[model samples]
Target: MKIFNCAQFVRNLSIPTLKFYVAQHQLCPDLMIDWSQPEKNIPKALFSDIRRLEAVQADELTSLEKKQSITLGLVRWQDDLKRTFCMANDSAINEFRHALACDPEATVVFGAGSPEDIALWVLVYREKVFRDAELHLAFQAKTHGKYWKQHLIPKGLDITHDQARLDKFCEEVAQIYQKVGAGKSSHVEVTERAQDGSVQVTIYVEGPLTVIAHFEKNQFNRLSTRIALETALVYHPSNGIVESVVKGGAKNHTAVLELFGKHIVGQEITPDVVEKKEFRLNALRDEMLEPVLDWSKHGVHKVRLRRAKFTPVGRAGVSFQIDVPPDMDKPDAMEEAKENLRVRHYFDAEYAMESATLIVYMSPAQDGKAEHFSFGIQRLGASTIKNLSSKNQAIAYEVLKALDIIDVLDGPGNPVAEEQPESVS
Candidate 1:
């Protein structure tokens, strides 16, 4: 049959089709784990014997792709491999959620196989959930015509006797009536009516996964259309590397929307709303930057912050002046100095939390390159230090006060002193 209104049909089928693919890769052979369970259902398995099952699947998936099934020998080998891996790493897996948070994308936690192997699958499955939603939306937008006639329309087109006739009508309409003048056609009212009646839906699964979309007419349900629509998403393949995380404005919404096309054109948030989002984002930034402040003493050289500006990306940024010893980078200079020369540090900033942190990155030269640093700051709240018996709020307060000083200095410094300082104080 000629393709008439495929967009609507594709969107309708998006969820089920994508779920089928995830089930193939995710579901246990005995169906002990239900891939359809949403995020909230995952807390129990956070400490379950999930690794053994994952390892078995990994081995079986590899062998099955090659030979199509686990033969008797393969089964025996798989069980033996599971026994060995489980014996070695079962307890460690349950204890190490934050152990690999340093490199969340590439970091591995314990599983039936290597933590690396399990992390690889985790990232993959998460993306599968996203991509499935995305493709559905794209398909729906592409084939909305088919959906309009077959599903959205009150009296659906008759397809049993004259499929060709219906297809031809849809093709002609899609091509000839693709663009309509405002208020020129009666169908616009009907289309708008369908959209208004449609329900916006979202499904969030634990393990850092979420699906958002809508149910329109009968067939098309776009899952998590907003984030999936604009962001460039990719599921990691085995041994794949994710270097950095990008938080785009499109996917990162200030508030949730119930319907897909209900665009917030002129809506403005109250000052209080803006402050809330900023406060939370800052809190998260502080949490992410906490590790850097663990060590107090500098190893060899000290870094001085001269100037800094908050980048549009909203992370810690700086224009630093470093103290470099003479002859440090000379051809015959000792190897260690070369490695420790560069500067990298991060400081966390939180408005509500009375505490923050400064992290210093010390990357000494390995073979022949100059070293670099990475630094950030994070603010603490009731939650971050709720469990610790004794916590330090001094550093956070001091750093924030210092930041105020920097802001003042950078804003309206002494133009009279532009001549330059006479000597280092």
Candidate 2:
């Protein structure tokens, strides 16, 4: 988790990339004598300035002041790059530029941090600007792991679990990738095979950068355009669930699923048949019951209802938010409030429970240190766990799974339970 310095990142950049930025008047504009001919010595001055800023002693400024200075420096760098891209005439670049324009806090999107962290953000920003087309296609393919969504294939379908079928499916996916303009060159390959009778396939696509400026003379330019989108397909034969991390959006997701059905299952798969795993209001309530989750068994010491929000169905722009005291050990008050609202027809069968925040006190594990973490659970399967450490996330996922909140894929193509219409007693 070592963060690299921004100065080091800048120093590592190829001369051509530095020249490209300088030529476009993106860096150290005041030092450039001629806009037409960017001086090779400009990087030295730029590096010197960045190093000087990095060399500032901690005692010289307060933490807040240092952060403010770093933020301003990073924001200025991002703004200059954005301004240059905004003036680009290319359609793809223009589209990206428009997005950049819309995102006023683009520099801080990755979160404000140390100069090294900001340096990584700057690198990402540069890639987005220079290789907008490739990134766009990769993004379309859902290259980012966090955003990967899951879908279940019907167990009733006659799925042929063999190498031949998988090979054929990969071929079809490659063709589809090209047809969908994912890239100029595309290939699908088997990336991993799990011992649990699951296989992972990756769809890689490469295309030329959409920027108007040509960087043919630059050695680094070759890598800039080689978009290797890891659109993964992890098929679990045990339950017929295909965890898809695709590049394209919903349309492409459907297309790929259709092909998956046709090639592997020998059947036509429609959106209706492919079940999406999500949390239902009733399921949430059911899981909250004591019988479902034994806190002691799950190493949970205590649970507190922090907040709950609900919207009455058919009520336009109306919602209710209940904020519970975090220190309150008993959830009886929140439960009573819900009952009160339900009896009054405010939270009846027509009510849609949106989300709930919970503070869970976990029993000490091997580390032997008890900890309490807060997390929010949404109806659409998005749960926000405040502590982003992998261990904490895994624990959260485990707890949610135990509560039948997340990854609750029961049976093949089992649709998420619909909200039950409860008659007011």
Candidate 3:
């Protein structure tokens, strides 16, 4: 039994947008007052009011809003006409009621049921209701980690016991670490930063054991370091070596693996063999990256950088769109500027979209008050991004990053790299 709470509403949804969602789903009014008009649309006011209600319990709301907003919500159950009446009269209930008495489309129904049954009905209908709702709100706010849950579980640390092998691997890493540090280059400074500015080769052993090796280059400063690390080993687990190499920057970089030639207690220590394998690894890596490059060149995906700013809209917050492609249906390939690799992969997996204009507005703190802040990525081609899934939004974000259309900005709306000034106003 899932219910659409206030927090979910605020995540990226607006009143009108939700109304459009209800209309799109043709969600039945929570309580139909009459029988003749069985199919009725939930009043736009209902959704608008819900958006306003969100401000009551603002702290719980995920999006950054000024006022407090509510967290609870009602799951309307259609049992019987009498039950509908009973639920509606209680002002405490934000229950959906029949539209105005004059609305002939309203239908009167009757019955009694358990909460699960009520939830069942709501779930069946609300999915489409909310799926459409989710699309409408997706672009308005970054809606991740905000969801309805029946239970909660704490995540545990990600360490396993394969002690002995890991110990040996880590020892190897330490040795490599010491040697690399000893031979530091005066021209380059190697730091333990997360960027691919350097390549890392991790060795994973077969007891399901794993080890990591890192290789870094300071192109800007002209220096490089290669370091390897191993994990702890446990009982006779499947032992195997893991290898990974990461390269960064616009230019191609190469890595040379230097493994000391020494045979282990039972295994053969082959240094030259490992170096030869490194060449194969590099070639494979290049092959894997080819699809991303091809996609970008063919225009299957277009990247753009975006600068976004959040401004106060009444008690809520609104994000304005200053630079976006003219075609909204065309997915706005956007991403954070720092995530270059992620952006590249995003362009590789692409989807076709139609064009449309989506204006997202949130209701103000008080009743009858509303604020307009963000425009759904104006799909210039055909369908609005409002039709996309959260995953789709994520990919779209990555493409945007490749284009440098991320939310990051410099002084007073200055894009990070001004050379790519977007033609869209």
Top TM-score: which candidate number?
2
Candidate ranking under lDDT, highest first, comes to: 2, 1, 3
Candidate 3 or 1, higher TM-score:
1
The TM-score that candidate 1 achieves is 0.21
Query: Candidate 3: lDDT over CA atoms?
Result: 0.25
- Order of candidate numbers by TM-score, starting with the best: 2, 1, 3
Local accuracy of candidate 3 as per-residue lDDT tens digits, 37-69: 322333334544444544443445454332311
Give Cα distance to truth, residue 369, candidate 1, Å. 18
* CA-lDDT, candidates in order: 0.26, 0.51, 0.25
Candidate 2's residue-wise lDDT over 182-253, tens digit each? 565555554222223455555666533443435532443433344455556656566666666665677667
lDDT of 1: 0.26
Residue range 245-269, candidate 1, lDDT tens digits? 1122322221221111122112222
Clash total of candidate 2? 7
Worst 10 residues of 3 by lDDT: 276-285
Q: Find the 10 residues in a row with the least total lDDT in model 2.
A: 416-425
Off by over 4 Å in 2: 1-174, 177-182, 187-189, 193-197, 207-209, 212-230, 247-251, 254-273, 277-293, 306-309, 318-351, 365-368, 373-376, 380-425
TM-score of each: 0.21, 0.44, 0.19
